[model samples]
Target: MGLQHTAFMEEEVRRGLDPKLARRFLALVWAQRGLVTLSVVLLFLFRLCAVATPYITKLAVDRYMNRPDLPVGDRLSGIQWLAVLTLAVLTVKIFTHYFETVVTQVVGQRIMHDLRLRVFNHLQTLSLSYFSRNPVGRLMTRVTSDIQALNEMFSSGIVALLGDLFMLGGVIAVMFSLDWRLTLATFAIVPLLLGASQVFRTLQRQVHRVSRAKIARLNAYLSENLAGMKIVQLFRREAENRRRFEGYGLDLYRTHMKANLYASVFFPFVDVMRAAGVALVVWYGGGRVVQEHISLGTLIVFISYIDLFFSPLRELAEKYNVLLSAMAAAEKIFGVLDEKAEVLDPERPEPLPDIRGGVEFRSVTFAYEPGLDVLHDISFTVRPGEMIALVGATGSGKTSIINLLCRFWDVRLGQVLVDGTDVRRVTQRDLRRRIAIVLQDVFLFTGTVADNIAMGNREKPRASIEGAARAVHADAFIRALPGAYDAHVSERGSTFSAGQRQLVSFARAMAADPRIIILDEATSNIDTETELLIQDAMRTLLAGRTSIVIAHRLSTIKRADRILVLHHGRLVEQGTHAELLAAKGMYARLHELQFEDEAGARGIVQAGEPSDRA
Candidate 1:
């Protein structure tokens, strides 16, 4: 073997028997049982060819070289036949080996692909709370790096380990039948081989666990920093961010080196044990040949058998280390899949009619984490086609109200009704389809402008897309682009300005054509000129649909049919904008503060100004 050969492994990974995870993993393997069975069978056939070759060599040597009792011509012809048979067996073995690789590789790739999709689909089912607690970098590792480890497990690790066991069995059975005493002598080093293997496996596991943890940590830090790089640069904290990143990078490098150290030590240790086993067979078998107790052919075959048996044992250990990484990866993947969706749809969902846009919150109280209430005893209602505005101090649960209405989070104490139906009773899909939201921080995926506008709804025609853009007054800017509606948008619409992104978002919501519109600070980023265009669209858009607008600007707030002021998560005031303003309460003070902060026009504070003030 090459001195430079090293096993590819991660940190100090501990192999666990997470019983529930094991069963789920086994079920996945069982799904492809037919292909798996055939691959194993081919591996077994290859082992048979390997074991038979040595025995044929023994026969050729004895009959042609040592047995002068037969004619020389006959012995020479027999030797030629043996050589031809040897060539044929090796040819079959090589072909079967190639086919096995093909089958197993395909199986491995297919399994990983399904696992990735399964994880992503399950993620979609989970509530926003799950994502809030977990970071994107950590989840990305589960889908990419972790899945790659499992691919190795399926393609070559576990299957190769099985083949090694079969090969070992064949070698042991054949050797014992050929000569019992020499087999016993060869078995003398078996205990040492087992002992060394155990020690190496323990070391490998420790190294692997360490490596995997560091890699996952590094990924988390990288993803977070990348996303917030703009803020980091804006604050002039580049040095601090770089220092933190360097610490994570250093930790990963240390753990990786430790894993590599163990791997290098393990393969060489196996090689030494292999050498010991071969030496024992040679010493005993040579004595037998000298005494004429066993044929020279038999002695030679025993030596060959020693190589076959020990080689598999060595391979089994290496592949077992790879399997440890797979087991760890499986634990993480299954952990995500097992998490229950905190917000669930009814088993037998109530039928939801086309929404007339009436929304009511009847004594609704909510909290993200238990005992930390963000909203308390909140009750309000919007009649069909009514435009209501929500105004409050920061942390007064204004956003929480929107979350509950959208069913992103269910209210703890009361019913959030769309039309006459409690949101919990209405299926989530049906409920969401009837409402549209345009958020302040727009999230646009990478695609053409038209595709982003239409979002995922595939039934929309180009004309409909254009109409939505025009209604949002976004058609002019979109048409000015190089490819107009077909122009490519970069990540999160970074290619466009803030106003342009908001307009694109408005177009998206309009295309959905929902009965209720939630504009949560949607125009906070628009310039005065663009704000005028949007204000024009707002009048037309909110005409026949119920709308919930969360705004701080006095102008936008005053336009609402009614205003509800939340103070410390409690509804402190509710009535028409003039009525609340005249009452001289929380609404009056909030309106005064807003007027003091901004000049006229749409009355929105510019983007990047204080978004929330308590």
Candidate 2:
């Protein structure tokens, strides 16, 4: 049947990635093994050049720049050679970084694409029940925002963390080699650094988790508001909604603030510790240099190594945030992925091929939720090419029957059979292809009028599309619009009137050319004149097909081959309109009520409800 296309994807993006999903993300990273390996090589090469620069400077200072004892000409050539070597090393650093950025970013972007596709595909496979429970905004968040967190992590997190560790290791090795005593003194502040880092880590995790959930809430709220913006304005809810949104915004703000607060406290803490380490090195190494235990060049290199060592450690901390965020996002993405669609094709599906439409519900039972049956022990049979009408009070399971007929849901007990084959035995795709349903609420996509008429059957020729519209009597009005059949339909076909949209929906169903046609209050929006035009066209439309109609109109129901009256969830009566009136049950009472209701508005003796439907 039809479902509304909502604008409720008005979502707020949060920076979130998953800690639990990290290993799986690593597998994604590892999937691009070649790129990852290249990045590693480049990172190491970059760090090597970085560490070598100071050592080269030290060599130049001790052996060439400081050695005035050599011939003046020789010293000048030596200095020039050292300067050229330093420049070459600097040039290499630039290229290494350039290549590293390109590879890392490409791999990161690819991973993000794959992740979004995975989540979207998973969502597609999920049952309608799953969608009924989850908000569109939340799914939109996972695909758009949560996955974006992984992109940040891929571009910066894991790679940076590894590279920094490698750099830290190299610097530590170089420092210890230069002077063990000085290296030991420099490491005195490391324990304090670790403690502060641990504290920040805890704070960051809590902040990320809270931010993830709060941002999801914000997105859901915003989506709901935007979709209902008309209602909000009509009811003067702007001030109240704004206040509610402000509360959500404040929660999000506090979440970010907590993350930033820890980050703010962390950097200064790290900077202080770095300075302490540098000071320790300067005091200890300077004494050694003064006593002639170590050369001034070695002392200088040791201090340079200290800065190199601490810089990467600081980088790793920032990278940790990205890692945590990515992990959180991955966790959310995987949560959706891990859930299997409750409704799926059977392993050995029976074929539903080239058949006349005859539907039978044999002792069928169903429900939207467990233990609360919406349809109970419902048994009915429609002959091939029969036009059956279902009249019911609210919650009488008419729509549920249509849902079952289409295999939108399986029967909980007994069987719903199409041409004597159990509906559950066939693939849903195949079964639905044989049924065309037009509901009260029609959803029109953005496309040309002809394209909207064709719907997903994109290969349908212009002639076929035009023919479908003509068959539904939609062609005349469609031709009146700008550019006629080629005219563009705005989002949800908003440019068209409700009656026009319904006509297009009729055209779409007509184009499908199914054996079974279901119209659930399909003529509700049409003006009486247009409804008459549709009713005339529908006779031809239903000439060979089995039609199941749920409408309040006496004109529509009176023509049905048989009318089934329902009360609560039971099929309480079944006969023709004349027969049902002769029986004088719920059908007669409803008929009388609808006659009075339409009399006040249309000044016609037609039976139809103005404000309610079963």
Candidate 3:
């Protein structure tokens, strides 16, 4: 047990020493280091005054008791001196305590501010893949609760712990000076107190760990439930969800109870040891006083110093738990800071100027993972102002092609060139800015309709935004709304229908006036009426620009200058729709399948023709 506890403490200390986060944490506190030092100095000065008060008290007691018959003038003088010292100490102590509180609060808030901003900025830089895997609740807990725990460590724990250490050292020094033998006897309980504290700290840390884990789980459950409330109601799964939530809630409650139980025991145990220390001090000091080894006044001074000494011991015990909690919080925060960015810009990247959007894929074979190619030895070229349609079934690498084009992920086996320069050679920001994409899943931020449309060009005038919306036929519906362009969109534009959001997305893309446009299943989720509107918008959006359209519907690709039929990550056919139909290949089969479905809906079947097999 002892070995295990030691190892745990060592691990916690090691995690707390992460150099990057440690530097950040130190920088936060370092800004106020001068003020903190002044606060400490003032606190120590107050302790000095406090220490002298007991001596003054001893002198007054000795004078009044042993020298009662002294001259009235001398007694009055002594009493006045003691009163003056008492008042001075009281005044200094009060102001110093106030100063310490103010300084600690300022330092704590500054550190928290820096930490929150740093964490939020780092989170923004992290890849989308990280967010896809981690729960929102867990991330929020790290940002909020974890940082709060560290705040406690800084605002109260560190200051109190330091002051206690100073008081302990001062008391021991004074006690030994007064009477070393009795002082030694009074400190006999030190080892026992230390041992008990270490044991309780270990237990408290374990309890805290369990409690934190349970809380994270509970938070995850709450977030998931809230986000999927509509789905739960639609499927009538409220009872099941309630049961699951109760289980998580109960687990969190039990863990919190256990932690509180451990804390409850820890303080009382320390209090018992404190009581023992006080009893030892009085017993040993009484014997010394009886033997004339120490004067009554001196004994009283020793007792006062002992009381001051134990105050820090008690404080140290209380803050041990906070220290452990801070270490845990720091470990989790540093874990994020330590994660290396998987995709980074090159050290010396060349800039591309006046790009003409002539894209070429030279033997490009790519995969998300090693030894598994999703696009194998694929080669293609798209000249400026060309429209290319990629027609394929589900999981046929169409989206992967778009992902590579946008440089969301780089090709592994070969090079992708834009305007005779390798995409990897140019800055990612410059490459992405030149391209605009309208995806099947249209996302709208919480803002006015005009604002959403103008997202691509925030500096664009309201006239340009309205022009884009009009070109996409979205202006009619938008103007019909309560506030027209100024109407606010709810979260994800839940107020708008799916087709309306897609049209707004189209307008957003059009507003950018990008050199290249990508439509990846952009019209798949829209109705026929909306699709017609988007088609008209696409004609204008794609004019004088390179375009790539990934579509499943055969009707959408009929007008493409060239259609590339992909199968199993390989391009099977490439030609105009008419030319492919004449060839009677995969494109022809898919076309027949779609045409037959239309004919079947019309209650018509051609004689002597086999049913479409796509």
**Candidate 2 lDDT, tens digit per residue, 1-614?**
00112233222224344344666778877878898899889988898899889888788777877777999888888879999999999999999999999998988888888878888888887887777777877888899999889889877877777778888888888878877888888888898888888888877986776677677777888887887877999999999989978877887798798888888999988888878877887888889988988877888888788789888888888888877776666777777889877788989999889779999999988888889888888898999999998887667777888878887777789898999999888888899888888877778888899888887677898898899889889999999989999999987787888788878888888898999999865565458898777676677678789999886666678778998877766888899988988999888898787655774675333333211112
Better of 2 and 3 by TM-score: 2
Q: Evaluate model 2: give its lDDT.
A: 0.80
The TM-scores, one per candidate, come to 0.93, 0.92, 0.85
User: What Cα-based lDDT does every candidate model obtain?
Assistant: 0.81, 0.80, 0.75
Comparison by lDDT, 1 against 2, better one: 1
* Per-prediction CA RMSD (Å): 4.6, 4.3, 5.8
lDDT of 3 by residue, 373-431 (tens): 87888888888888888876666678778878877778888998889888888878888
On a 0 to 1 TM-score scale, where does candidate 2 land against the true structure?
A: 0.92
Q: Cα deviation in Å at residue 400, candidate 1? A: 0.4
Name the better of 2 and 3 by lDDT.
2
For candidate 1, the 10 contiguous residues with the lowest summed lDDT are 1-10
Mark the 10 consecutive residues where model 2 has the least summed lDDT. 1-10
